[model samples]
Target: MQGNQLRTFMATEQLSTFNPVTLQLPCGMLRGQRLGDVQRFLGVPFAEPPIGDFRFKAPQALADWTGIREANSFARAAIQSPRPPTLVPDDPGYSEDCLYLNVWAPIAPGPHPVYVWIHGGANMAGTTAQPVFDGTSFARRGVVFVSIAYRLGILGFVDVSGLLGEAYRGSGNNGLRDQIAALEWVKHNIAAVGGDPDRVTLGGESAGGKNVISLLTAPGAQGLFHRAICQSGGGQTYADQLMAEDLAQRVRIHLGGESARADALLEATPEQLLAAQASLVDSYPAKSPFRAVVDGVVLEQAPLASIANGAGRDIPLLLGWNKDEAGFYGASANGDGGVVQQELANMSLSEFDQILIRYPEMFPHLKAEALRFKALTAESYGVPTLRIAEARARIGRPAYVYRFDLPPEQGAFRGLCVHTSELPLVFGNVQLPTAEAIGPVEPAAQRMSGIMHSLWIDFITAQPILSDATTIWPVYELGARQVAILDEELRIKSDPDAGERMAWTTWQPVAAE
Candidate 1:
């Protein structure tokens, strides 16, 4: 169905429903709320809560329930140290029992394409309860939108198999396992809520983006979704088994001593775990330690290598990065160049020299230190994204690449399209208060939001997209390498930054090692 026809049908359907919506699924009956053109089911449990005995273990499917469950409110966010700007309003607060997901669907009939979102907070601190993630826009555009929550920090990514033995062999990736289980639930039950089981699109930003890309190589994630959209996160980095174990050891040290047993770490309270996690993060101030572990069981190899060898080769992808992703971290006056320096420190002598030479004048307007920071963004976000697109293109798959260059004219991220700057525009929540921090939501910005939002809706619907009679989004093939540049004006450029791409060949992520 086309966008206009779907909206018209939904408008007609809206005239018939003044009552709450309900669905009788295999598990039980759920009573949801009807919000104008959309029907929303909130705080629906998809898996058994990962708490107490289930802590640090793979998620178990929720058992069938009795009676009609009220699905009107959002569940508690995953346990973590709450960060500003990203926190949910009138916050549902935090908890270990946070495996619930929220859904939004069009009121009109039939199954619509599904869009499942995994939120981004370095895999240690985000929740789907944020207002920016509200699915009203997508539902109005005739799509079923879902946002899921999972365990975070030590509870989510710290590998304890080395200490706890075989039962927790893949425990480090419990967060990812939670995401897979959510997809499984959607695949089996989304049909009841006007979602097409075969046409699901998984998308996310930052840590969430990294998770979706990792899912491309995850054995448990195959056939769960058909398309992917990764925003401002790349597949170049991941925690290998050794790195995962190091995090486990650090947690133990913080809890007791080096001689601490598995029980000492596992039996610790949520407060104790958060304390240890804080210390762990402080120790490694450069980057987030929480990431999917390449354990032999869950993931046999690094994601990029697996993708190169044709893992998820058939899935169409919409991949891109902002003009300055790392700028988000360095936005403050007392900016820590530690993150950029640490990434440079990971490189060899020759690789480090190459970066300094190539990036010192890359962005001529920025000062010396700022230029290096931009280079870090290119190395971390740009290079890996381009590499993944190239891999998919080589395998003859569709990879619609884009580059978001529209910086805010005013506010915290003024003149810099930092990480997550495209979210408000893509999600069509430009007027939200949090969005104002990124930039002013003036008429020009609103127009930009419409252009970016429409592109995403088109990709989810698997329809041909034409921005105008003259401009078309071309596939990122090996030869052409066309990229849609989204700014005040949309421009499709061929290999926009050739020089910067070449400078990144020497350095490689630890995952590659």
Candidate 2:
């Protein structure tokens, strides 16, 4: 089904009632819903919908409502296509007016810890309503969960230039701004729903995790969150701001708008602009290139560079990525296989020779495999993790790194954890209709889930993520780089692949200019 139909079904089937509550938001009365022990407020507008004259502009504060507005179900997801068919069968349709958020808080009184989740889709796709993202588990554990919907694709990241005035000056970071708006909303209204406004933990996987790190360094987002957890992605080596602008210009040219200036591009209809942006999916860099930019205002500098300079010193962080991250890329590239072969073709003769020199033993038998693995790891997990850890160490803040190595046994591609394998385990929602229908939940999965969730909660409440039975999570030092390798049996390892890490550290991109 399309996204709108699925959303309608979810609203009618999953969400059943509306329970009104008064909030101090500019809007006086807001009607939310009560689901089991938690009261969920859906489609609560954090910022005014970015439509009509507001298109491609920074978020504006929501206008006050005279009476209670029913917030029982999710609003539309940001404008983007459904996730690739191989990953998720169902397609959630997209829309332009999609800047809404959902909240799940304990119904009983007293302030509970809040966990704000940002969903992942390479910054181009994804929604807040994935079954794996259900907040019931966290709410049951006495934590409030908030999921946000941010602008995506061109609407969110397009650099329209400052000619449109300051309102549109920061247009490139609208998605990041949307997230800050949601946090701002939580800061003002979560307390009313029995959540501690001061103890918010921002977490996400893939692009969501990347956004988590972006918010960590954003001046506007500094005080909005107390803690952060990043899974699979980080804001270390992001697409350059100029590159992002160039992509925006491509979209403008495709839409028949003037590319020399921002005014002509902003004049196009939202649908026209979105279609132009969507057309580039097939042409986007092999590695996802559209992401949070280093705009000097919202983002003063690259997250990793800023962190290396002692930015975000006060906030604690839990960051990690999975093993076989390249496995998914390999799988996704299976149809054409050229995706992998072409990437292997692009490595410089020196870098290509270096791969042979560094891993002479492993390179001979698996040269092709090594190329694919290296490309995947560098883009998906390696660079992100290294940057995050390096920045955290530079700031002298406590940082714990983890590598998930649990391989899936049933999927077409066996012996690989792939991207998002940790989601079901982290949320304890392995019992979802889809996963259960696939097969019985593995006992190891249960153990892994317990460990992961326990570590997360512990990090939120106490600065450290430790358990009675587990090994101590040592802080990541620049040299030692201690990280927990999570699997059937957990082990504390220092630099699991020192050679690969070292090689990638010095590997610079071919200048995009």
Candidate 3:
């Protein structure tokens, strides 16, 4: 393992050039590869492949390796529903063995803050492999960026705790476990990749936003990430244990069996389970089928109640939702606009009356469809987010809040300030399908992109948000209600919608009722 032979081994494997990409990890040596100025280590396993008996289990740490492990390509995405063609590469693969993470670091050294990104797809579909989530920009800006792929759909979110006993109690949240494993890898090995483990930031959008919030309160995920950014996600989206158990039972029966035995389910293929799970979900329209659960272990309680009780109070959280989160969110496998329509139709006499009376005046000019979509967005995404901010504020923990009020170009997706509109801006990948569909990217939008990206990098790097005096953005305050507005002009403002905030404070969802 000395001089000449070692040098030959490293060179042949694409480890490094004049500047080698070899990093000594607790697990083993990871010979690096490059993509331009950024050194990338992809397909690195944080956990053992969750296949076979490991299918319904928490992620197990990867076994130690002997020589340089290949990290030049991405691992398969979690086996789940298909992703939008626009969001995926040409030959995107799928697998149950999908607990891999990718790292991007500058070619030069000295530790930098690490940004851990989790993709969003209503907790059902998404991959770190998306072009929009590439970490090259963050790396170039002196931050080590890592994106991870985790379990989804039936494999990740099915709760069999009650039926299967203690062995599989944490099965419902294997995806969260996968994320924690990735964080654990960061804590242990990010230093080798020019990252400061102590300065890790967790960020996500949409369903990924929900994951960030969950990790904030997640016992296993504590102390793993220092800061968090939750975009257009934060609601107590967890299904109660009874509900999850019931759904699991239905899924088993739909697979042509009434047996509630673990062995029975173990025999079924992932495709069979996913198909049956989807069938069972079609009946329960308004709720996300594959979601987190209060398993009394990994997650002690639901997000709202848990965080309100001061869980993750010490972690700095930044949150906001899009101007229009509904229509542009695409169809969630759990619940879509059609399901919302059905639920609205079935509301009780009193509930229906209340909405009919209040909504029109509240959103005066919105058409029927727009009104429904906006209401759902607020209830599902916006209101819960504000509630999270309030929860933190009540506990004497200040959280940064923003309202993405930027409008898109006219005739491009009809200029809707829709869900995920800020993604390209944040990632500095402005050539997305959404951007094209929304027409030309304006100069103001481009400026906003730089500002937003800089602010994000600044927070992660533990630096001041700006180099100026006038734009000193303050953390949100309950009394003064200050928030950053990201749009044509970046400025501070009071709570964006006072009336809507008040409505949700008193309004509970139908399930809670």
- lDDT of all predictions: 0.82, 0.73, 0.76
Ranking 2 against 3 by TM-score, winner: 3
RMSD of each: 4.9, 4.7, 6.9
Model 1 spans with C-alpha error above 4 angstroms: 1-19, 85-87, 331-354, 466-470, 510-513
Considering summed lDDT, which 10 consecutive residues are worst modelled in model 3? 337-346
Kindly state the number of residue pairs that clash in model 2: 2
Task: Order the candidate numbers by TM-score, best to worst.
Answer: 1, 3, 2
Task: Output the number of the lDDT-best candidate.
Answer: 1
Q: Is candidate 1 or candidate 3 better by lDDT?
A: 1
C-alpha TM-score for every candidate: 0.92, 0.86, 0.89
- Tell me how far the alpha carbon of residue 178 in candidate 2 is from the true structure, in angstroms, after superposition: 0.6
Model 1 per-residue lDDT tens digits across residues 1-513: 964356447645753564688988778999988877888999999999887788889999899999999998899998887757533545778899999999999999868999999999888998787778888899999999999888888988888988888888889889899999999999999999889999999999988988899998898999999999999777866777777878888889888777887788778888988998888787763476888888987787888878888888888999999988877776433553333334531344356566767664665676755775677778668888998898898889889899998888887777788888888899998866557665436677788889888889989999876463457899998887899998886799999987777777656665543
Error of 1 at 354 (Å): 4.1
Clashes by residue pair, model 2: 3-92, 3-93
> What would the C-alpha RMSD of candidate 3 be, to one decimal place?
6.9
What tens digits encode model 3's per-residue C-alpha lDDT throughout 366-449?
766666667767766778788889889888996888878776766534556777778878887554443434322578777878
lDDT by residue (110-213, candidate 2, tens digit) is 68889999998877888886666778778878888899999987888776764456666778888899999999988988887788989999999888998888
In the predicted model 3, the residue pairs found to clash are 16-20, 412-438
